[model samples]
Target: MEITLLQGIIITIVIMIIVVDRHLEALFIFRPIIVCPIVGAILGDLNTGLLAGGIVELAFAGIAGIGGASVPEALLTSVMTVVFAHITGNDVATSLALAYPFGVLMQFTWTIRNTAFTAFNAPAERYAKEGNVKGLMKLCFYGIVITMIITGILTFLSVYAAQAPLKAFVEAMPDWVINGFQVAGGLLPAVGFAMLLRVTLKGKYVPYLLAGFLFATFIQIDNVLPVAIMGVAFALMEYYRSGEKEPVTIKGGEESGI
Candidate 1:
């Protein structure tokens, strides 16, 4: 539960790298599913980290930043949730509900950062017009570096400085309040999936969805691997069927083929 100084430093560095990756939109490692396990490993609680990551990933699966719209911060959510769960020895659900506010706070910070970065546009244009490649590169680099540093500091503070207070807050909460958070956290993933289905589901896929639901709900499988395998098989079948060409028929008879 106690996060050492070295662990905090490592986590900060990891966060900085993730933030850079996010800005670059490269590798896609900023997702909770990826980052949570890594943070957990650093904290010597890989299993809890993985569990938290999976839940948080599903909960945020349908949420994305489109155009100027802001979404919850997955990186902060993943980090804080894992840290809190490990620190408090609480369920991932409770940790997720608690850590979500940090995600919102970081989202607001991200919006502000983006707005401020617009100030660099004029200088960037001047550097481009003057063919000062170094200057332009420096301008861009500075923005990324500043973002990394700020995010790292915030993450460090949230995990290190805020841990005691957060743990105290959780301890002070009533059983009903904690239970409510757990329930809400458990439902979030379903809500996220529904949001995704709303946008992507088609009439043709209804059967598959129903089948999956039945298998998952009634079949009482130990894990989802079998269902996933069935899905893969169905997908392959669909792919091959779609690729098959239908036989072409002539308008008249074979005698008219001359």
Candidate 2:
């Protein structure tokens, strides 16, 4: 009943695919951290599940969906964090032993999946020409479903396959390895930040970005909750500032039109 890495991975995959395929909702809850704990709950490790999920969530605080892609690879991080957490006594920092690498691996998979989806869109357009909205949706839906299912299965199976190595690594890891992982923890935030830059960044928004970063780092805004407040405030200020009517200058530098 204690969800092993293999079973946890398996369940997480199924849930992830369902969310990704059916909902098209950014795969948020079905993410690795949430999925892990739910699996753990089913497996009688509720505490472990919750703890693992919380830790991964913090580490992935900056993760965001930009039109579609997410940076620092939330999916892989969530999944692997729970798995490693399960293996390593629910110590959040320790989970990074595999979570970071797993995230990188998932990034490759996601890029490949999206590329295939883009390619499929062309054929889907042909189907769309024939009044086949259903067909087009099917193309996108089934394609995503298939990809999710395959990744889910492979993730679970790979967990099992890698279990021995994971155990060995955890056991034999030098203190430096642990130290390195902890240090890697600080750097992980940069990944999400960089990815966010790629997604929401624009030329005029630099001040807001810097402000949010400063508030978060220096002003002690904790978690997504406070950040959301600050973001909303920032947005309101920007909106009103930009919405203010500007005066039109005439040839003599005087306002002409009201």
Candidate 3:
């Protein structure tokens, strides 16, 4: 699949914006939930984009760069999956499998980016020592620009140059191997859930967890929003309950005095 000039430009711009948002604003516009639709719209396939995005979002939900360590990158993964699905007319599972390597590659890129940014710290420290706020700000701005350029170039190369080889590789794989990829893709979300549980599971929160599981698994809620709303209500109740103070009881040993 060939990306036209206009498509390439749009994708590049989106990639740059996502990178800047990640580094500077951190407003989550770069998140798969938001970015997938935009990429789909660019490629004239919003439904596929949304589907791919949702799957990636769920699968990568627990992935975060915690304690200054880089995790598997999500933005590039989302972009690659949506674009692959859109161009090749593949299902979400296949897209996810194909994009996994790209995500790992981006983890490396993220670490390198951070390392590059760290180099400027010496200058920043010097500026700080001199009380030169403007110099420090300039260094920060330089880092932002470099980040955008690096991400943009990486994204463009992935979209434009790598697709043909990737498509060929997938086509050449045996049926069992391809199916294996799909199966792995389907199971990857469990990893995300396990990670999330590690952080959020606690004795006090078990009942709400059970409630949500029952609602989704047994009743088979058609839409997830209602279950999310129910969760919010439960959370609010727990919050208010925690705020309540126990009543004080005084021993009754004396008669009333006028």
TM-score to true structure, per model: 0.88, 0.69, 0.89
Error of 1 at 210 (Å): 1.2
TM-score of 3: 0.89
Report how far off residue 5 is in candidate 1 (Å).
3.0
Candidate 1, residues 132-186, lDDT tens digits: the string is: 9999999989999999998998899998878889888888999999889888889
CA RMSD for every model? Answer: 7.2, 6.4, 8.0
Question: In candidate 2, residue 110 scores what lDDT?
Answer: 71
Better of 2 and 3 by lDDT: 3
Pairwise TM-score winner, candidates 2 and 3: 3
10 residues in a row with least lDDT, candidate 2: 249-258
Segments in model 2 whose C-alpha atoms lie over 4 Å from true places: 1-6, 9-13, 16-23, 30-33, 39-43, 47-72, 116-134, 197-238, 247-258
Q: What is the number of residue pairs that collide in model 1?
A: 0
**Predicted candidate 3 versus true structure: per-residue lDDT over 1-258, tens digit per residue:** 455668877988988988788775468888888888888889888888899889989988887777876788888888888877866667877888788888898889888878777789789889999999999889978988888888888888887767778778777889888788789889988878878877777655677878888889887566799899998998898789768984675554343321
| The candidate that achieves the highest lDDT relative to the unseen native structure | 1
Candidate 1 vs candidate 2: which has greater TM-score?
A: 1
lDDT of 2: 0.64
> How many clashes does each candidate structure show, in the order listed?
0, 2, 0
